[model samples]
Target chain A: MNIPADLKYTKKHEWARVEGDLVYVGITEYAQNSLGDIVFVELPSVGDIITSGEAFGVVESVKAASDIYSSLSGIVKEVNNELIDHPERINQNPYDSWMMAIEPSKASELEVLLDASAYEKLCLEEA
Target chain B: MKKTPLYQAHYDMGGKIIDFGGWALPVQYSGVLDEHNHVRNKAGLFDVSHMGEIMVRGTEASLYIQRLITNDISQIKDNQIVYTPMCYCDGGVVDDLLVYKFNDKKYLLVVNAANTEKDYLWMQENLKEEAEIQNISDEFAQIAIQGPKSETILQKLTRCQLEKLSFYSFQNNVNLDGIKALVSRTGYTGEDGFEIYVSPTEALELWRKLLEAGKKEEIVPAGLGARDILRFEAGLPLYGQEISQDISPLEARLGSFVKFDKGEFNGKEALLKQREQGVVRKLVGIEMIHRGIPRYNYRVQFNNKDIGFITTGNHSPALGKDIGLALIAREYAQIGNKIEVIIREKKSEAIIIQLPFLQKKYKK
Candidate 1:
């Protein structure tokens, strides 16, 4: 599990990369590895309203379909269109295949997200 | 959760373990799609020891078995196996199982691991004559080596001529490098393979031996996840999904094994009446025209009318398409019939297709 120190993480195994007012959302390495061979990924639309801890999209592997939780409440400003046709990118490089870029409505939620070290400890405890 | 003998072996090989029914089994090793293609091209080994095996032995074993299953067991000879469904009087299935005939005095039934207890109780409740029923699942361990290269790989260890074994047949007391076992030329995958059964005590050694022997053929240890997809693609009926306590074999398109002329059996009357009137529902294959995967228990409709639901569905790498098995009204089962598979809250476009997406490659 690669928990990069630069990004903030959630207990649900989602990561947030805060860039000014925008926070890029994608599942963490542990999440993608757990859901191997992702055959399909349903992306949240660009204009969709997303709430923290709520599922805005679905990520599907061969064996199961998992809900992708939003770590920050926001309006989806940009969607990763590449992942719709190539969901395997999430498995190949989860950090690079960011699912969405949200303009945060609740900026304080991003402050509550776990740091990389805390998330790393959480993964170890779960393991 | 129950653990099989190969539970530790799976962990040592980096297999991702999950709870399968009540058993702690590996759901995947490398990945589902990779293992699926490996079984299609090369050979893949599976730990199927969790499956329940029961023995019925007596002078009236054949007669007892005849009244239990829907298939004509009398039509099969010694050392052969017949696949069948045990049904309730209401025509609902008890379980779909494989009946292995050792002789007129003895028989072995391989049943679903989850339904073992229920199946045994059903047999005991329906016992009509003097016979012995034993749940021998714990005493034995089963491993299946499946694919095009399976025979060549297993041939390296066993001196028994693999070429001589016919499909749906088993040879007992076989020597696989000093390990006594029973090798059957039968498998759930729609590919050529052998399912070997051995004593539970000797199973781990045999598992390691076979993997080492099959190293040249690139045999990977597969899990239940791969097994499900292979069988699904092969158009085989699963116990809980395809046939269940609520679903009958007739509706599952397994009427071929239901012999109307084969003497009286458990559900013969109701099944016969069903045959006379024609089955009300049918299991058909459907492929998605919409982007979403038509998953299990998803509602299916025809012209906004709820007809049925998806029993099983997933993204198939072989077909490169999203597909599923749906149990729907008989009137809506026509091939090329445009239908809708309700994926989530939305109804997605799908078309009724033939049962098997691909032809089975069983050795003739």
Candidate 2:
């Protein structure tokens, strides 16, 4: 349950790292843990427009499949190609292995997500 | 949620708990794939205490069971086990279970955990006057030692000569680490293994002892998650998935387990008619040719029409690809038949293949 102080999280277990115009999006450790042994990742194509709290892709685990949601409204700028061959990388290093890079239409939308501490508390309550 | 006698041991070994059929049980320890591979190559022990055990006894025990199940119990010899389905009057399956014949006057039935209580009541109501049925699920614990190295590891702790035991056969009252146990050369996984039945009090000690004794073989404690994946790879039909109260065994492709030639069994007439006419739907194996993985309840399409739905699916740890079992129209179950699985409103191409997706190697 490593919640890096600099990152923001959503109730859906997605994390966003605010980096000026580009924000890195990936699932959190807690999300990957609950999903169990990720096998395949379907990433949104670059240039695809996504809305906050909407499903943009799917993560298939050995036990079940789950939808990955967009944390903020954005246009996908890049999708991680490494996940195509090695989806377990997301399980190994969820925070560092970003699923996609998006250029937000409104970067201020990130403020609606919870901070690291609040997100950690939410995760505890979920458990 | 019900906890088995070995619940604390599972938790202490880093098992991840989940609610399975109203029972609080471990779904995995390390990971599903890792545990699956361990059982395939090395050895793995499973706490199957949640499985139901029932005893049927009396002078008419054999007659009572023959009228209660779809399979012929008369063919079962002493110390032998038969895999079959218990069906409702309407030809739908109640549950699939293993019947072990102890003698002419007594028989043992191992049923699915989720259907234990229901099955017991069903049997009690339908039982004839001469026979009595008892539920003994709580009185015992079952441990399955599965994989290629299982025999050698288990041989070190048991007095019985495991080499003489044939597949689907059992020996009673054998000493396992000074405790009497019933060891059966049968398992759900597609591997050579033994299933041991012991008193609940000896379960934790037996598990610990086996884990320690099996160190060289790298035997691990597997959970339900791994068990599901392994059985799927073997093409074994699960209760709720492949067959259920609303689904008949004929449609589940388990017709071999139903002996129609044996006269006057439960649901015999319905099955006989079904056999002559054939079922409209049948369970089949699907291999994903596209990127998306198919999951349970996903729609199956053929010839631009919805034909069926997926019963179970996952990336097989052994095969390393997306595979699934689905119930489809009998016309679409042919090998190399092309079909589509609907995933999140999009269609993914799939092909019907012969099961099992992986080959099995049961102990002789």
Candidate 3:
């Protein structure tokens, strides 16, 4: 529900914060709330090439396991190793606890992502 | 999806609802870990009305039921509950249920909700004796109060001397919150607990009354998630996961429930043959030595060869370790056998240990 004005969102409930060539990506607050008490987070390794809309990792809670998809095609530059130990941090602050940093193939892909208001509207519609 | 009698109560308590076998049930109320720990330490309440209750009554009901189930029902006295597996002719489990004997002329069978219709049809098809079987699942609602403080909380409502109630026994026509009910000293969680069965109309009232009585004990409302975890930690066999139509009770380490010495049962011949010849696959406990949570249906391997698959696995809140139950080849079922669980296309090291990842704290 907390959609920061600075970040772009995807339909799969992922948020991307663009900082020059690198885009820090994590799941949205809606995704974290849907998945209660995350016990394990499998993140993509650094230097791994990921495709747009493809599953790159998994997020397992007490109830079920869900696939975490990549928002855009990119090479993973940094992985959040801290999440492996404290996956519940995402439930505490999903926007601040970024999962991975990726160097996108093209900066123009950002245009396709939804803005804060559009993303909030999409969440409302889905709910 | 079907809703239980306590559905509104669950929603009012902020339960996270999910579809479980076509039933709209709560997966968690407070949280899975919190609810599970509360049951282990203090007390917790569960809405188990989704379970099916069948009443069989006739002059030959005892004989018919004894012939239908695997456990020795004749040994049980009146008002005693016996856990057993009803199997097909091939020694494969049809379903696991609890038989509550009222007398030779009457009895009650509690079955899994998802398998109720199938079991009813099977029982009808295999009916060789004269008895009346009625599906009374809709008429009743069941709630389980589990933990060390369960008696302390539930005793405040019922006038029956709960201290005199032994395990696996029940007292009918007990006054619970001014309503006539059947209270049993049995539960799925390996803890001192009571399972109260009441009419659907009085279910919500009894649930609210219990919550109020146990407020000082910090008894929280639990859901299917905590129930599943607690049963797993207790090493209780679930029907679809541990024993299914294709899986025999002997393979599930439930041979004790299948009494070969007692006369003939439905799957007695096949089970006798299986006991004579060894079973090929066996269920065993596995603990992750590597860093990964083994999930259901995950392939288990040794030396790169697939030997089995995980039935149930989770990050145990009590043990603080990743544990699972796997049905593997008999050769790999030994204690301390090294294996690997293929978790998300990655093999994680695991070792076969003794079952019941956590020690049971039941009151005998």
Q: Report lDDT per candidate.
A: 0.92, 0.90, 0.91
lDDT of 1 by residue, B18-66 (tens): 9989888999999998999999999999999999999999988888989
What order do you get sorting by DockQ, best first? 2, 1, 3
lDDT of 3 at B113: 96
**Candidate 3 local lDDT, B1-364, one digit each (tens):** 9999999999999998999999989999878888999999999999999999999999889888888999998898999999999999899999999999999789999999999999899888877887989999998999999999999999999779998889999999999879889999999998899999999999999999999999999999999999998999899999999899988999999988999888978999998888888898999999999988888899999999999999999988888888999999998899999999998788999999997787877665
Most accurate candidate by DockQ: 2
Off by over 4 Å in 2: none
The DockQ scores of all candidates, in the order shown, are 0.84, 0.87, 0.71
Error of 3 at B233 (Å): 1.4
Error of 3 at A14 (Å): 1.4
Error of 2 at B42 (Å): 0.8
Relative to the true structure, candidate 2 has a C-alpha RMSD (angstroms) of 1.5
Q: Residues A1-127, candidate 3, lDDT per residue (tens digit)?
A: 6889989999999999988789999999999888877888989999999998789888888878899998788899999999999988998899988999999996677779999999999999988
TM-score of 1: 0.98
Among residues 3 or more apart in sequence or in different chains, the pairs in candidate 3 whose N, CA or C atoms overlap within 3 Å are none
Tell me how far the alpha carbon of residue B100 in candidate 2 is from the true structure, in angstroms, after superposition.
0.9
Candidate fnat values, all? 0.80, 0.93, 0.60
